[model samples]
Target: MLLSPTFSILLLQAASSLAIPGSVVKRADPVVQLDDTTVTGIANGTVNQFLGIPFAQPPVGSLRFQLPRPLPSYNESFPATAYGPVCPQQAFNLTIPSDLPAETQEVLEVMNSGSTRTISEDCLSLNVIAPANASVGSKHPVIVWIFGGGFEAGDPAATDGSVIVNKSIDLGVPVVYVSINYRTKVLITLAFGFLAGKEVQEAGIGNLGLQDQRLALKWIQRYIGQFGGDPSKVTIWGESAGAISVALQMVTNSGNAEGLFRAAFMQSGSPIPVGDIAHGQVYYDSLVNQTGCSNSSDTLKCLRGVPYDTLMDAVNNTPNIFSYQSLSLAWLPRVDGIFLTDDPQQLVLQGSVADVPFVTGDCNDEGTIFSFANLNVTTDDEFLTYIQMYYTPGASVDEVKQILDLYPQDPADGSPFNTSDQNALTPQSKRLAAFQGDAIFQGPRRSFLQQRAGKQETWSFCNKQSKALPYLGSYHGSDMESIWGDGAMSDYFLRFVTNLDPNGNTSINWPRYTLDSPNMLTLLDGSIPLQITQDDYRVEAMRGVSGLMLKYPL
Candidate 1:
């Protein structure tokens, strides 16, 4: 059939609008075909990206809080140029309270910088970055990064992968990068994936965000080759909650990788000792009542129907990680009887972790940044309440008293660990940091390594470089700059992804962590830095606090 004159003219006008007067034509949109669907992506310099590519159907309507469903076969074209919106996040950096110390204020800036402001429910997407030379013929090893925000917020869009891809290309060890987004802090200003109630438990749909991640891995397995990635060699890496997420993924299937990934990298986090979903019944109930879903036959479905803004307001008004019991995040992933058969600590004890080569480490002062939010707890009574509320509520007064004795009141014995009285923002600030850090980050990581030492090759590091803000010495995420920048840490990471060992071409002797000699690579900011040191510091403190984590997890 011949096109009408009017229609032909319209088509020509549309084509002309896309052309620059004398610009040299380069190429059509970067094209990729998965199974049968054609995705037209963006080509920028030496990095080619297919962004906002859906790895699973949108989790909305009837699918809310349910396990992600793989998209069926398709023959349509998908425009993969821009990033997908992130999952909902609380409006960040609104008005800051003025009384905070200058250092604490500075710490907040970096922590808030990691969240992407734009958000929507349709955020289950992943981005693929490859070297310009990559194609079906060049199967390069892959690096998959997961962002962290206390399981309350995070956005893959907040970070750039071109840096990694370009660094790999520069060092002559090109690799592909994949970053993904998942629902977090559900019903809150954002959505957390693992909110559970009896209604949810019976349905077996908790941990929706993690399900989103596993689906992305499956997608990579099915189609990463089209973008010149070796799916079999994918290494999962993350920092903070993302790091905790990496550890959780290891134990989810009783250590069964299911051929989804081969190795792991964690920064400042670990498989926490969170209890069953029933522990979160209060938050679920609060959400249901606030969203006016109390009488609804199916509360989860009722939540899906509530007005978005209304539901967000209710969730936001409730207790959050920053509340009095700082870091006791109520909306975090818990043992839901499905994805997690039991508490992760028990799983680790049962040897249910993947027997893969891994690296796990922490910043010099992982607690400083986290402790900034609890500057209000200055007195001994407040401190006791904090311990009961966040650490061991059921513990008798003697247990709380024992915790105080172990942590002590002296700033030097506290966090920003060797800084002495310098960063004592409050009387109890340093003490709180010390206790929280060991309970949440340091202790779990050390325990994780000790449990896996004889079974797998593992390396640990302590980042003292980029020790930002005076008080928050090498605080949580202090290593991020080096990890993403073309710095030593980044170089080591590239080497690790390219060849499962981080000591690829360096003379630096990074040793495997072991029970007999628990050595860690100390990354400091000076020439001749990066020393191999023993993991003996804080030994007594960690041992003293280990049982608290086991009894009452945050």
Candidate 2:
């Protein structure tokens, strides 16, 4: 029975549904030995699992604030089962949308029950999941996932890879999955981890979290073979700050992946136009002042010496994505002369992006949830103050007016896309949401595609299935359910991982993104009605926003 390509993909999806993870157990204990040290992992029917494998030495004590150090060996029989402690981070809470359906609200409760979780500084670890049949006789392509929280928050424990691995087995395109954890916020991520002042910059160390990711990739290249993964075939993927990091990794070392990864995938982030390391002086000063290291001759060394709790106390006092700044998060990757020599946008313009096949996309209303904190802003004057203080502070009055004019103040004109007048929380709420949706996520993504399409095989998408969450239409992180669940997005991802192209055998062909065509595959309802439409949402308005970004690179 030779099924056609389209029917074959559909049948494969059906096969995946029947064998959902944990439904059956074929193997009990699976042992994978690396350099004479044996780490034991469990096995479900379809995929073998290895969790909490140390890719790097725990960055504790004197290693605080330094780049990740690769773990030397795993010489003993270690049980790799439960998750390690997540990176230390301030507890984040979201004000649930009032109009959410009872069912949706219930789901949120289940997700948030573990919101109050513990974390530790000893958090550099990774997890791997492979098809039960993977081996040297069957080297599966590796899909390494990097999680996102504006680079200020996120833990690798949040993502599970069993379904995707199972999807591959059904499709006859088996692959391996890996998830990683690095530093974030002041603990060791965003630009905050690589926080630099005049002294720290002189020492030439920044973007430490990104460096941690790079080290993890190197680890994969060296050790994934032991778990039936191909070292030469790797795709690094992420969303938001993780997406931003994916783009940064594409451009780092002048777009040379250093033989670590061969492809990239992103969700709602691009090579952001952040200024050099010195711009983060305020946060660095606040950290030094809080930790009583302001007077120290070597603040970097002093930070390394401070107790974890003391350092975390000062870090928690800092503003996060939920603060008044909103999507204009202060703690994120920046141009460090070491990791990044110049502005990432400039680097892209100068043809600094990786020459690899990649997929990048954004949700329809990326800023709705992120801008919820700034809803109190009402009048035009306050809006101008916000633009000056957070987004593009140096923007002249005329430029700020230009941005406001483009985004507008009408609820219909703002995000939460199809909703007419229901989401106008305040006079300026919808307007701010519109601007942020474009500036942080949409604008950069568009420019990156235009600049890099010709240089590489690129694909793009826009997730418009808002899920009817009041004002927060297809908000940030909305694509996760479809991509990770049993939907076309998940199928597309399985196909993409199988053959670096989402349209490998699916009926809905995803065309390569190019400047001439300028089309985007739209994920709506995650059904057959999913569209491949023009990428012309808000062209002129977004163009103006990109111009303003030069003067104020957030």
Q: What would the TM-score be for candidate 2 when compared with the true structure?
A: 0.92
Instruction: Write one digit per residue (lDDT tens) for candidate 2, span 1-554.
Output: 00001122234456755764555546767888888888888786678889888888888887777778887877777899877777776534445567765644543333223224468788888999998877654678999988876666676655567877877788878889999888877534433365766666776668888888899999998889989999888998887878888999998888878899888888888888787777778888888899999999988888888887787778767776667776665567778887888889888888877788989899898877666678778988888888877888778888888877787777788878778877677888877888888888889999999888787889999988754766666777777666665565777777786688888667578888999997788888645548899788789888998878865776
Give the Cα lDDT of each candidate: 0.77, 0.76
- Expressed as tens digits, the lDDT of each residue in 1-554 for candidate 1 is 00001122223345645655455455556888887888988886677889999888888776777788998865788889999987865433322357766756645654544343567777788999998778986889998888777666777765678878988998899999999887777621134476766776887877776777888889989999999999899999988878888888899998999998899999887888888778778888988988889999888888877777887787676555555555777677888887888888889999999888999998887777667668888988888888887777767787777778888888888778877688788899999998888888888889999999989989899888755456777777777766665555777888888888888676487888999999898888778667888999878778778776787654
User: In model 1, where do residues sit more than 4 Å from their true spots?
Assistant: 1-28, 91-104, 113-117, 187-192
| Model 2 steric clash pairs | 183-188, 184-188, 184-189, 191-332, 466-474
C-alpha lDDT (0 to 100) for residue 415 of candidate 1: 76
What TM-scores do the predictions have?
Answer: 0.92, 0.92
Task: Estimate candidate 1's alpha-carbon lDDT, on a 0 to 1 scale.
Answer: 0.77
- Candidate 1, residue 192: how far the Cα is off, in Å: 4.3
